[model samples]
Target: MVALAKEKQKELVEAEKYVSEVYEAIKERNPHEVEFIQAVKEIFDSLVPVLAKHPKYIEHNILERIVDPERFISFRVSWVDDQGKVQVNRGYRVQFNSAIGPYKGGLRFHPSVTPSIIKFLGFEQIFKNSLTGQSIGGAKGGSDFDPKGKSDGEIMRFSQSFMAELGKYIGPDVDVPAGDIGVGAREIGYMFGQYKKMKGAYEAGVLTGKGVSFGGSLARTEATGYGLVYFVDEMLKHKGLSFKDQTVVVSGSGNVSIYAIEKAHELGATVVACSDSNGYIYDKEGIDLDTVKRLKEENSLRISEYVEEHPHAEYKEGCSEIWSIPCDIALPCATQNEIGEPSAKLLVANGVKAVGEGANMPSTLEAIDTFLENDVLFGPAKAANAGGVAVSSFEMAQNSSRVSWTFEEVDAKLKETMASIFTNSIKEAEEHGVPGNLVIGANIAGFKKVADAMIDQGVI
Candidate 1:
């Protein structure tokens, strides 16, 4: 026992030094790119022991090359609003890696979109896609175009103009883009229409997240949320517990959160709260999914409107306060860095049994560290929230074969994929002598697969 402990300590020391060196170089090269730097640091910090085992990675400078994007495209997107005024937005697509396959990720259209943010998301996508063990690479694209308060015609025009430029770089088997924060069915429809117009071909595989009327997959809408619940179920089941009669608090009212609540209810768990950027809605009787869907999807109103229908429900002003509600499980389905040290401590104190991220990098480093130290069953975003992309791969396959799978078939596949991912992550963690460390386990497992592929491909 003493020798094993001493050897583990030495491994950690060597790992830390290697990680610090790589992190310093990344920080120096990418000045003022805080989000990108943070992301690179987090993954690098987790990869020390993995790197030490693979000397060829160091010889080829794979760490540095992987940190840099293979190709980044930036262009001007100009469209006319309903009032006949010309508006311009900056667009970007960062093809992070293509070793495993073509570029595959989502296109997010939010006001916060920037090069640093896109690069950070793209970098994370590389591992997220790799964890699925599918033939897909990592890429992310979007524009700083907020769709809120825009008329339907205005949005369609903006999407068309954006795709007019984006279509040139993307194709069915080259790079396929899906939807994220602000890019949903409506946006995808417009973009697909524009792509077809430009290419003069029906390339349904060029995009995911399409509505069911076209070549879209049936379970695409519910995949991410359902998959998250499925992953959490696997984790709890490992410890001989289930979501039966337990309370759950899920952040965000978007598609991921709503369907997660739906799946939780289907699995016999009572969901108590969900939130938006403005505030959160809490109903100890459990939130009504119909009302949430109506307010957010139908009316496009804030979550505060949910209180009007359910008078007993409370509407809080701050979105982060939702973490204060005691629950058996907490799922951050919202944006990046939503949970920091304070929220992590609060959730731990409130007895959150597990945390599964539905959104990318929803928890800060401090929060993740705290969860690890406290022995909380924390699921990293790369492994936990990969269901959406996994299903997207299914969609691509369906389109390629000119077939549409039934909803049951797709849902079953998604559940199996999520379970496989959870099992693999645990297997990797245990083998690396860091049982229960999903973050490290996911990083190492995904990195090794990509690294070996990159090496075999001869350092392109």
Candidate 2:
């Protein structure tokens, strides 16, 4: 069996040679492009069976069309600082795939923003959005201007300048970018305000993750985190267990982790740890969500601050070690590759039964393998963290209909969508003779949808 699996892997690699060539060409243009190439290649390699199953996809050269972005926009954003100094930054919007519908994703704002990262994210978004059963396509855009420690005026100016150029490419029926990472409600508001100013119209659907009064969905802030929990709940149900008495350890004290902890606690789970970039706080007795929220949301303090308020809690200087602590379930919501092989081994050894990703690609490939080998109920990011984009699609629907869905209505829809995604992923994995390998299942399931669309569209 091992030999046959190795042979199949080799065949898959060989079949992807042409797609690899395109990625190599991009890499030659810029060495930094390798990251994006590797990310896309991983998905492509797992999808070889789909190509074999549907010869029409190969006949139509769908791989080429899938990798190539439908549209790309680049522009310079010049904003003035409080000192009247003009700061110029480069911005990009990659509308990766829209065979399903208009491009949809998030706008990230950080110094780490680059074409490679955006492309990788956009590629992942394609699968993530598809799993939601929504009609939206995949796209991602952002600027390399970091908002951290920046004055309000500077952020406003940067956002306005960024939107002045971005507004030309985005619309209610075209590309829609929501908040991601550094981009949040404040940045969305600033960009939306500028977009409205330039277009001379109020287009609320132009961007998602908006403030509640500005047509944002009620659970938008909590969607990704809550969705992570929802996916885990379904996974546990298969094992005849639930979050009712489980203990969860989540990394990252940001939006996703905060809300995930909240939802886990609300569902009768004890959340023992939450981390930030610097470090994590562990309270075996269970974390104080209110205190954590105040420190993060109001004071904007590091997660270590929770230790001062809670005498029983301990703070660590490193975020990666959060997985070392024992828990019934683990959710890595910090950043890509934050959880690796060592972490995965630790969690499994500690008897962790499930892991639901709340961040995009948070687990390394080795980590994913470790989980699968241990028979851990794993939720791949594409299906697990899709709640954010799923709700964004709901917001788009409300905008098009000139109506707003009640909080209850939207939340119900999100729950149903997440449950369906898990069911589909499981069915696909089982059909492929890898019933527990959700990584491959998610890629194959998502690729089949887009591949079929490409064939139907006549090789566009």
lDDT of 2 by residue, 1-460 (tens): 9998887777556556655665566567557675577677668767666655555666777776788788878889998999999889999999999888899999989888889888889989898888899888999989899888899899999999999889889898888999998899999999999999998999988999998888888889888988888988988997798999898999998889998999899899999999888989999999999998999888888888888888789999988889999999999998888888998999999999999999988888888889988889999899999988999889888887878888889889999999999888888878766776778788888888877887778755
Candidate 2 residues lying further than 4 Å off, grouped into runs, are: 1-31
- Candidate 1 lDDT over 1-460, as tens digits, reads 9998887777667666766877898889889888898788788877876766665677676787788899999999999998999999999999999999999999999999999999999999999999998989999999999999899999999999999999999998899999999999999999999999998989999999998889999999899999999999999998888999999999999999999999999999999999999999889999899999998888889999998899999999988899999999999999999999999999999999999999999999999999989888999999999999999999999999999999999999999999988988888888877888889888888888888888889967
lDDT of 2 at 343: 87
Best by lDDT: 1
What's the TM for model 2?
A: 0.94
Instruction: Enumerate clash totals for all models, in the order shown.
Output: 0, 0
Give the lowest summed-lDDT range of ten residues in model 1: 51-60
Measured with C-alpha atoms, the lDDT of residue 276 in candidate 2 is 85
Candidate 2 local lDDT, residue 180:
95
Q: Which one is best on TM-score?
A: 1
